[model samples]
Target: MHFFFHGQESLSILDWILRAAVIFIFVIFTVKIMGSRAISQLRLLDFVIALMLGNIIAHPLSDHRIGLKGSVISTIVIVVLYLLGIFLSLKWPGLRRIINSKPFPLIKDGEILYKGLKRARISIDDLLAELRKEKVEDVKKVALAIWESSGEISLFLEPQFEAITPSFYQLQTEPFDLPQTVIREGRIDFSVLRRIGKEEEWLIHTLRSSHHTEINNILLATIDRQHNLQVFLYK
Candidate 1:
């Protein structure tokens, strides 16, 4: 009786180990096949695939009689179908268009497209909310608004002012435009010299006046449009 009990206990432990191994293998295989994007940025198709994969794996785990071969076959079939869908999307432009529809133009030439809003399944309230998020109080200020493929809204604003004419070109001996050095990390930029109409000698003299002995010590330096040298020290 003691020997029989020991054999039964050993068999039970072996079965448990086999079940665990099956689950581990299936989980790893499914996750790998699904790709890294499954963890984040889940799309509609991705969500459906994930749900189906979970159900397939659960069935084998619950029923020991299902067999590993059947589970593997089902997983492969699902993966193949997913790959085929992706291939169809790429190979056929029309099918791709059907699967991932084009962006709907919500605004054109400062006018709201009500037809686009209906096609996108969004209401006027929804559009107003989106415009508010973009900090646009008036629709007239918006040059264009497009509902992107990712379900996000993109807005383009009209220029603030019109271009000046030749009549406005009056020269009053203003200081020449200076190139601002918004970023610097050690090396002297020759591009900046050409922009400010000054050579290396002028830059060296400017640095010396500011008590900065080396260019490496300065983190950032800028000459504004007004030709004022602004230097920031490295920390």
Candidate 2:
């Protein structure tokens, strides 16, 4: 234990472990309070807060000279400021403009806007790569493309180039229903079965008669809204 915690200054193995656990729990609590968008959809404000929090929290974990108390207090203050900034951005239009940039047009009316591309700090080659990612072979097929503040390109295909759906033909279709999993990895999910109003005996009987397999043989099984039991067996 001494060897493991050597050169860590005065922090013993147990002390280091306790500090790590506390920091980990504290960070999780703060993240929950800040909301999922802080990590999932990182805008300018979110990015800055995330960067700052990571830097502040990391130093105390490694350096004994930096106390955990100071880091924790600093983190709480930063999180509060971040929340306040988000609230202010929502209430004040002027402040929002400063924090979040408006979507810049990269392509308009099937023509690439070179000026917009320059403003976005992307070259012609980069624009072509993004187009390729959207499965667009020709620039003329794009009706409009906007560079979002989150650094993602939003592409819209010309009406003529858009994929045809059943709605286009005015065709009738069944209502969409998500299949509920009853069995996974050869184990039956009784809670799911209960929720879907199905019995254990019925599932066993169905597997043996319909799928010609036993419960242990199934890798996955789902029941649809229409009482259709689909089973997949292990390979």
Candidate 3:
């Protein structure tokens, strides 16, 4: 990481200036060409390529021996090879399949596939760890677990365990102000009433209008954006 040093004279002034431009372009090109797969997942090949590039580029910048031109050529060739891989992967589906690993199921229908985990090179503990990251404490809760090609675990929980989303009911939502609890557990939250610019008299009048004359009868009451005070009476 000679590119990250300070107060060192490993190379001449011109050498530093020239190599900086090359390094910048090299990094930009590699990252852009590799796509999010290289950044987020970082397959074994990508990791190796990145490490090689760092060493290859830094060596020439650090000493007068390895010469800047050779490093530049090495960087160019590496970038070219990567670009070629992308082009060929696009032209030929079979080659693309070879280059990129497909998602493999680690768990199917709540059963842990030991053989699948073995083929994926993932240990039982590692599989559990990835599950834990998704807040899955037990494999029994998982309906399916796929080891993604991007080196991440994709978890699918049983239908009963999945959270109910708005889409489930086909309900649409509109923006609304946060509801303020005006009463809780048969206690009048005067602070909330005051903040919402209402007094005890107003609360009593509103409750009476709804035939709920007594505040102690309210187990919970909240004021919504529409200034509607929805009250839940104590049983």
Query: Which RMSD does model 2 reach against the true structure?
Result: 9.0
Superposition error at 128 for model 2 (Å): 2.2
Worst 10 residues of 1 by lDDT: 1-10
Report the CA-based lDDT of candidate 3 relative to the real structure: 0.74
TM-score: model 3 vs. ground truth: 0.56
Best by TM-score: 2
Judging by lDDT against the true structure, name the best candidate.
Answer: 2
Clashes of each: 0, 0, 0
Poorly placed runs, candidate 1 (over 4 Å): 1-44, 54-72, 161-235
lDDT of 1 by residue, 90-112 (tens): 89999666545577799988898
On lDDT, who's better, 1 or 2? Answer: 2
Candidate 2 achieves a global lDDT of: 0.78
Worst 10 residues of 3 by lDDT: 31-40
Please list all clashing residue pairs in model 3, or write none if there are none.
none
How many clashes does the backbone of model 2 have? 0
Give the winner by lDDT: 2 or 3: 2
What TM-score would you give candidate 1 relative to the actual structure?
0.44
Decreasing lDDT order of the candidates = 2, 3, 1
Q: How many backbone clashes does candidate 3 have?
A: 0
TM-scores of the models, in the given order?
Answer: 0.44, 0.79, 0.56
